[model samples]
Target: MKILVVDDEPDVRTLFEQRFRREIRSGEFSFSFAYSGEEALTFLTGHHSEVVLILSDINMPGMSGLELLRHVKHDLIPPPPPLVMMITAYGDTDSYNQAMELGANDFLTKPVDFTALKDKLHAISTA
Candidate 1:
């Protein structure tokens, strides 16, 4: 599966790499990283068809993840938008509600639980 991970944090790329090293090496998954919402949009515009899912951080400096979710779920043309999962460090009610209203496939809290994430991904993949 091809996944695009959008976050402003530079270390996120390294962290995801470490966390999913086995899947990467085994050819079960391929990942692409975008440092900002804008970058993620650009990447999506160019390669949305190949991306099966998007993992995005909700709070960002510019063009927050919610905005990006809007674009992905509502703006960018044609049918069949990629499944988007929102991640936030703040476990608040408003953000969660907003994300769901914006059409997030799932929402997760930060310091992401890799085990649960893996399970969710597996379930999504099979579905």
Candidate 2:
């Protein structure tokens, strides 16, 4: 599956690359990283069809992930939209509620549990 990861932290790219190295090498999953919501949207504009899932952090520098989520859930599509999972360090109820309202498929808190994340990814891929 092709997945887009959006976060402001540059290190997130490396972290995801390292954590999912085995899956990446096995060709089970391919990732595209964007350091901000705007970048993610730009990438999606040209490659929406290629993406199956999006993992986005809620607190970004420019366009917040919630805004991005609203756009993805409402604006893009040929029918079935890509699944979006919101990530955050806060894990606050307000953010979680907002994300859900915006049509997020899942919610994950940081420091992400790679083991659990892998399982979720496997489930999505298999399903």
Note each model's CA RMSD in angstroms: 0.8, 0.8
Q: Number of clashing pairs, model 2?
A: 0
Q: Per-residue alpha-carbon lDDT of model 2 for 1-127, expressed as tens digits?
A: 9999999998998999999999999999999999988899889989999999999999998899999999898987664679999999999999999999999999999999999999999999999
Off by over 4 Å in 1: none
TM-score of each: 0.97, 0.97
Candidate 1 lDDT score at position 70: 96
Tens digits of per-residue lDDT, candidate 1, 6-122, equal 999999999989988998998778999998999999999999899999999999999999999999999886658999999999989999999999999999999999999988887
Q: Alpha carbon lDDT of residue 68, candidate 1?
A: 98
Candidate 1 weakest ten by summed lDDT: 118-127
Q: Candidate 1, clashing residue pairs?
A: none
